[model samples]
Structures are given as C-alpha cells and as structure tokens.
Target chain A: MKTYKCYCIDLDGTVYRGKEPINETVQFVHHLQQQGKEPFFVTNNASQTPDQVLSKLSGFGIEAKRSHIMTSAMAAAKYIAYHYPGKDVSMIGERGLHDALLENGVNIVSSSKEVFVMGIDREITYEKLAQACLDIRQGATFISTNSDRAFPNERGLMPGNGAFTALIQNSTGIEPIFIGKPQGHMLEMIRLEHQYEKEDMVMIGDNYDTDIMAGINFGIDTIHVNTGVTSTEEALLKSVRPTGTFETLVECI
Target chain B: MKTYKCYCIDLDGTVYRGKEPINETVQFVHHLQQQGKEPFFVTNNASQTPDQVLSKLSGFGIEAKRSHIMTSAMAAAKYIAYHYPGKDVSMIGERGLHDALLENGVNIVSSSKEVFVMGIDREITYEKLAQACLDIRQGATFISTNSDRAFPNERGLMPGNGAFTALIQNSTGIEPIFIGKPQGHMLEMIRLEHQYEKEDMVMIGDNYDTDIMAGINFGIDTIHVNTGVTSTEEALLKSVRPTGTFETLVECI
Candidate 1:
C-alpha cells in the first residue's frame, strides 16, 4: 500500500465516539506518530476550539498537537479573512467560532450588513435570529460553518447548525456559502497552510457523505472505515466510492 | 357591489399596520358593525390569543368580540384535538398556543411521541428545539400554527413560526401540517364553527399570498385591498386573481 505524507482524519467516529476512543484508530495514530508523521484532525464541529479538541483527544489517550486540529470554525474565519479583507463581520455562534474569528484578526461587529457567519449557538434566541435575517435582507453575505442537519446527543438526534441555516435560508431566500465537509474548504485550508500536494495527502473517516465526499471534493484519496455514520454496505452504494474500505483503522496500519 | 354576511378580514396589513390602524379598514369594519354584522378578523399570527387580538382591535377604536377573532393557534389546537383525540402532545411555542391547547382540552406532554405542535416561540432555546425533534423522530405527528417564513416587526422582517418550523422539519426530515393562511384551516374553522355558507362569506385582506390565497383555497370570495403587504398592481399580476380588487375596503363599503 502507498503511504500518504498528510493524513486528514475525521474526529467523531474515526478517533473517538463522543467520549470513548476507537482503540483501533488510536493505535493507528500512535503508530503514525512513532513513524514521525503528525496526522491532521479534521472535524466539522464549529463549537469547540482547537485547544478544546486537543484536550478531548488527550482524554482519549491520543497526543495531538493544537496545530494539527482543523475545525470548520477555523476554516470559516480564514475564508472570511481571505475573501473579504477589512470587512467587519456580524456573527451568531458560540465560543469556538468567536475564538476562531478573533484569532484570525477578523473585525467582529455587533451589527453589520457586509458579512455574516453563522454557527451553532446553544443560547439561540428569536431576537438573534431576527437580527441575522435583518442583516441578510440588507444584503449581507451569508456564511455557515457546517451543514450537519441533526447531531447525536445523550438523548437523541438534536438540531445542528444546518437546521438553523435552513431557517435563515428559508426566511431570507439566500443560500449561504457552507465552509464545511462536502465543500472541501477545510481540506484546502490544511493543504495550503501545510503546502501538501494532493497526491501526498489522504482523508480517512468513517462517514461517506461528509468525510469521504469531502475528500473526493478536494480531489484527494479517501479511506472509509465502518466505524460511524456510514457503514461499509452504505458506502459501497454510493457512485463515488472511497479509495479504500476497512473494518477499522487496524487494517490500514 | 354585493355585501356578504361573513366578512373575513386579515389583521396586520388590512385592519392595522403594526400598531397603527388602517383608517379605511377601521371605517369599513364600523360600517359592517352598524349594520349589525361583526366582521371576522382573521390572522396568521399564532402568538396572540383571541382576547389579545380583540384588545388590539379595540385599541384601533373597533370593538371586536373574542369569538369573532380567529387565530392560527386556535385552529391548530382544535385540529389536533379533533384529529388525534386523547393523544398527548409535545409542543414548541408561546402563551397563545399554550392557552389554545389548554382551552381545547388537549393534553400537553413534555415527552410524547403521539403529536407535536409547533408555533412561534419567542423564548426559543436549543434544548427545547432538540426535544421537539427527538419527539418527532420517535414517530410523533408534526403540526405547525402558520407557515409565515418572516413577519414585519419594529426592526423589520423577523423570523416567524414557519421559519422555526422549517428548522425542526429540516432536522427531523418530517413535514408538518400547517394550520395558518395559504392552508385554509383558519378559514375552514370560522366557516364550520359559525355555519357560514360559501356565498355568505367574503375574505378581505391586504396580502395576496396569505390573505387572498387563504380565501381562494377555502373556496370563498375574496377582496384584495391595497392597504398592506401586496399592492393592487401586484394582486392583478397573480394567476389566481381575487374576486375583487380595491384601493381600500371603503370601495366595498
């Protein structure tokens, strides 16, 4: 098997399932580290900062560097700073997104009709949502971190950022520029920042739609693991198959 | 011009414009009352109770009976109680919806998989929305008070119940049965409850889509007034024209 220099990995199912780590993937990551290769952790989660992700990974017995974590929030902030330079941004999101924009030196304004970034805000209110619509109606460009409709919790499937995005889109009749998986902005960020060629990079994940499709969209090799959202059977049904399939990361290692 | 026995009038754009009364509509309502006829005030507003709506009309110098005011929340509660008798319902809404369901004798449960009613919840939270999605995923039937994506407020157009409904619907992959305008449930409720025949009724409003379309869908005569959302010129352009078009209800009077 050919070895890739940069391994972009999905976190939720590939590294850990909520609080529990996937042993096979964790072992594979340790093996990669032993070989002096630091794999990048790519996640669509916009609520947690890289530091927070690093802490979570640490709890799961995985030693990951802060620079190796690429969240959708970071990508969104980078995209805004790159595309609309010096434009003040109004946002509706939580700490992770706030931190990302602040770190990226994007001017954060309370009210602006120029650029608006949306993320999952637990303390979401009708007033906040109204302000977003008001801004969008006033011709503000809309951007969202991820498009995961519903996320799993201790109780059950909960409303994700995508559901809120749908609300705003339905209200304003404007589709937002989604900066998450299946769009490949995150992968592009990793590639450009690290200067890794497409041939030397690979995306390894458990979900076919967001993870594998994201790799395919980025024109990179992808390995689908039957550990999370999309099982091997479901992944095979898709027309755009992954570069490889594994029962777990143990086979890849 | 023909006078109808049941004059169904829209509230926001027709009778009043955001706390200010449309003089022509108020005068027309007074004229109807002088002839011992109480015009029915129909609104897609699911946030206010019948008494609340009556008070608003009274503030406009028009005395309205509580029973004469038809709100979407009332219709939704009645619909749920009639269709799924004795079934417990989980809901995401405000005082108007709560009072209506209680008045209609529908059991409101916190975690029920029987029926789910959605309305404009100004104090909306992520947890509440998540719970609603969970209940719906557990096989609960979905119902929404109205499908108004956005409504005019002091700040401008604000996200309405329909927008929130869109959020839940997107998350759950379940379409809700909307009870408000353009669906004709509110009109049907007024007709069935008051025993008004099709010819005896004439729906009057300022908006062509919700108000005029409600009357059209309800199989009744409709008067399009240029006092609010849709202009007379815009109304004429629609493929399904209203029964009559006027600058104000003064023409009908």
Candidate 2:
C-alpha cells in the first residue's frame, strides 16, 4: 500500500459511528501519529466547531490538534472570505458556522446581505428559511456548507442542511455554491492551507458519495471503508471507483 | 359573459391582499350576493380555518357562510378520509388542518401513522419535520395541502406549504400528493359537496397557476382577473387560457 503525507479522514462514519468509536480506525490514526504524521479530520458536519471536533476525537482516545480538524463550516467560512471578500453575509446556522465565519474575518449581517451562507441548524425556523429565500430572490450569492440530504442521530436520519438548502433553492430558483464534500472545496482548502501536492494527499472514509467523491473531485487517491452509508458492493458498482477499498482502516494499516 | 351557480373564488389576491381588502373584488362579491348567489371561497391557505376565513370576508362587508369556504386544509382532510379510510393519520400543520381533519372524522395520531399530511406551519420544528421524513421513509403515504411555494404577506413573500413539502420530499425522496390548486381536489370537493355540474361552476381568481389551472384541471370555466400574482397578460400567454379574462371581478358581474 502506498503512503501519503496528508491523510484526510472523514469523521462520523469513518472514525466513529455516532457516539461509538471505530477501534480499527482509532488504531490507524495512532499509527499515523506515532510515525510523526498528523491526519486531517475532514468532515461535512458544519454543526460543530474545531474545538468540539477535537473534544470528540480526544474522547475516542485519539489526540488531534484543533488545526488538524477541517469542518465544512470552516471551509465555507474560508470560501466566503476568499471569494466574496468584503461582502456582508446573512447566515442560517448554529455556533460552529458562526464561530468559523467570525474566525475567518467574514462580516455577518442580519439582513440586506450580498452573500447568504447556510449550514445544518437544528433550531432552523421558517423565518430564517424565508429570509434566505427572500435574499436569494433579491440576487444574493447563495452558498451552503454541504449537500447531505439526511444524517443519522440517536433518533434516526434527520433532514440535513442540504434539504433546507433545497427548499430555499426550490423557492428562489437559485442553485447554491456548495462548499463541502463531493464538491472538493473542503479538500482544496486543506491542500492550499498545508501546501501539499495532490499526490501527497489521500482521502479515507466509510462513505463513497461524499468522502471518496471529494478525493476524486480533488484529483487524489481515496480509500473507501465498508463501515458507513455505502456498502462495498454499491461502491464497486460506481463507474468512477475509489482508488482502494477496505473492510476497515485496520486492513489499510 | 356566462354566469354559473358556483363561483369558486380564490382568496389572497382575489378577495383580499393580506389584511387589506381589494375594493373591486369586495363589491363584486356583494353583487353576486345581491343576485342571491354565495360564492365559494377557495384558497391554498391551510393556516386559517373556515371561521377565520369567514371573519376576514365579513370584515370586508361580505357575510359568507362557513360552508361556502373551501381551504386546501379542508380538501386535504376530505381526500385523506375518502381515500385512506380507517387509517391513522399524522399531520404537521396549523389549527386549520387540525380542525378540518377532526371535522372530517379522520383519525389523527401523534405517531405510528399510516398517512402523513403536511401543511404550512409557522411554528415548524426540526423534530416535527424529522418525524415526517421518518414516517414517509417508514412507508406512510405522504400528502401535502398545496404547492404554492411562496405567498405575499405583510413581511413579504413567506415560505408556503410547498416549500416545506419540498424539504421533506428532498429528505425522503418521496413526492407528496398535493391536494391544493392546479390539482383540482379543492374544486372537486366543492362540486361533490354541492352537487354542481362542471358547467354550472366557474373558478374566479387572479392567479393563473392556481385558480385558473384548478378550474381548467376540473374541466370548468375559469375567469382570470388582473388583481393578483399573475396578471391577465401573463394568463393570456398560457396555452391553457382561462374561459374569460377581466380587469376586475366587477367586469365579470
């Protein structure tokens, strides 16, 4: 197996299944750390801040630096700061998105915005969604963190930010700029920030559509594990197959 | 101009614009009443009950019988009762929907639903939406009141039931059975209840997509007035033109 300088790993399904940690993936991360390599925790989860991700990683017995975490919220903030600089942003998200936007020096506004950013907000309201539609209809640049339709929690699969974005898009007839996995913006951010070549970076995850597609879209190698949303059989059926497939990260290591 | 026994009039833009009444439409209704004809008020609005609609009409000096009001909520409840008899229904809507469901003798359940009905809910929550998605995924028949994406209000165009329905549909990949305008369910219900023939009924409204289309779909004559969302010019451009076009309902009278 070939080794890479930067291993961009997905969180929810790859590292852990909700609250339960994947021991094989944990040990793999430990092996990488022992070799003096820090893997980037790339997640389309824009609901949590880097510190929050760090805390979760620490709970799983893997010590990860806050900078090693690249959430879609962070990528969205950076994307806005880089592309729509000096533009006032109206956002519909939680603390993670807010914190990232502020940290990236993106000006946030309540209304009269030139740019609109959306993320997974558990406390989403009709008023907020309505405002986003109004802004987009009024010609604001729309951007969303991810296009995940649903995500699993204790209750089951719930509506993700993508569904909300779809609602706004359907209402306003505007397609948003998605800055999460499957689009490669998050991976691009990691590559640009760390100054790594495409060949030096690899994406590892348990999902094919988001994680593996992100790597492929970024023109890098991808390893798909069978512990998440997509089964190995389904992944193999895709025309654009992953660079490699494994039962678990233990097999990769 | 040909007169009909049933005048299926649209609300909002046809009868009143938000809290303010359209004077020409108000006088037109009075003319119909003077001729001993009580027009049926048909609206895609599932938020208000028939009594609430009656109050609004009375406020405009038009005393309307409660039976003469047919909201999308009423049609949705009736449709559910007729099609899925004895099925336990779960719904996400306002007081109007709740009232109509109970009035129609449809069994309403909090969970373990056989059918799920969606309406425009101002106090929408993630949990409610999540449950709706889960129910649909669990094989519950999904039904929505209307497909009006946005409606004009005091604040501006607010997200309608269609937008919320689109969110759930996107999350679940299940298209809902819409019981509102352009489907003709509401008009069909009015016809069935009043036993009026198709030629004896006419849909009168200002919107081309909802009012005129509903009449066209129900195989009845339609009068498009230049008072609301779609102007007469826009309505004329449609291949399926209304039976008659008027500057106001006064012209029809």
- For lDDT, the strongest prediction is 1
- Least accurate stretch of 10 residues (summed lDDT) in model 2 chain B? B151-160
User: What is the per-residue lDDT of model 2 for residues B150-188, given as tens digits with 9 covering 90 to 100?
Assistant: 887766677888989999999989999999998999999
Q: What is the per-candidate TM-score for chain B?
A: 0.98, 0.98
DockQ of 2: 0.73
Best by TM-score: 1
Tens-place lDDT digits, model 1, residues B1-253 = 8889999999998988897999988899999999999888888888898988888888999999888888999999999988999999999888999999999999998978999999999899988999999999999999999999999878899898989999999999999999999888988888899998888999998888899999999999999999888999999999999999999888877
Candidate 2 colliding pairs, count: 0
Candidate 1 regions with alpha-carbon error over 4 angstroms: none
Indicate the TM-score of model 1: 0.98
TM-score of each: 0.98, 0.97
Cα-lDDT of candidate 1: 0.92
